[model samples]
Target: MKMDAFAFGITNWAEIDRTEHQGETGMAYWRTRYFGNYPNQIRVRWVEYTPGYRADHWCHKGHVLFCMEGELETTLDDGRKFVLTSGMSYQVGDNAEAHQSYSRSGAKLFIVD
Candidate 1:
């Protein structure tokens, strides 16, 4: 991804408003910040997944994601699956692989896309 022009900044995630996203089986809450303009923007987020959460759709967007607490399982459209636990991270390019996620016991993550 191209890094766009943006000034230095610090974020207090707790001060950001949380938005809810419904999953196939649960819910996800996110605190997000966007930098730069659309199409070249950088999105940074603090996210939480409710227990038994399973993404409702396949995502083709690129991301740099870090697991901060609990666990997350990611499944590719081709059936490949992987797991992430605290301190683990994954990176994927835009349109690289269509993927979805699940969390059986809830999780926290930091993501940039």
Candidate 2:
């Protein structure tokens, strides 16, 4: 989706499409749904991971993530780990460094990229 710089918008989670993630393995399945083509090419989405879920690839891009429901852990290639619970937030740059995530139980997050 594309956005017009001058436009304004409003939305509710129920109104957006929930798209299944493509590609990946492990019991690590997940789903993401977002609305709006925000300015500066920003994308906002709601992501949920199943119990014992782990991401397929290490992400190198920057993101602003907020934990909305459940627990999730993010581990950097350098072995740094961070655990986030509800109401917690994390922000990182698009440093070419690698990072991956997992959840022992399950997790729901609001993410901006």
Candidate 3:
């Protein structure tokens, strides 16, 4: 798919390129991508968090996430916990919460930001 093209119908992830995303500490790392939702309406990617992985910082960005494999957890600054197992999904509006994610056993998720 063309990077500059408008997002529309189906596009396969297997055919899309990926980039490694780094954090402030680099300990919370994952592969990422963007596109497939029309211009800049939405960005999509698959996140792969290794076992014992967690994000380097609390994030305030919103996302629509679909659990594709394994398990992962999202914690709100207020100590709320949200877990995503295989086939489980979650969503949060951008910058709605000061949250972070962790995976005791790793996880693969379909994410739209």
Best by TM-score: 1
Error of 1 at 14 (Å): 0.5
Candidate with the greatest lDDT versus the true structure: 1
RMSD of each: 0.7, 3.8, 4.5
Error of 2 at 109 (Å): 0.2
Q: Write the per-residue lDDT of candidate 3 for residues 14-79, one digit (tens) a residue.
A: 766656665432333334555545645556677777777778889887888898888888899999
Better of 1 and 3 by TM-score: 1
Which runs of model 1 end up more than 4 angstroms from their true locations?
none
State in Å the error of residue 4, model 1. 1.2
- Residue clash pairs of candidate 2: none
lDDT of 1 by residue, 15-34 (tens): 99999999999999999999
Candidate 3 Cα outliers beyond 4 Å, as residue runs = 1-7, 23-40
Total clashing pairs for each candidate: 0, 0, 2
Cα-based TM-score, every candidate = 0.97, 0.79, 0.76
Runs in model 2 deviating more than 4 A are 1-6, 22-39
Q: Each prediction's Cα lDDT score? A: 0.96, 0.74, 0.73
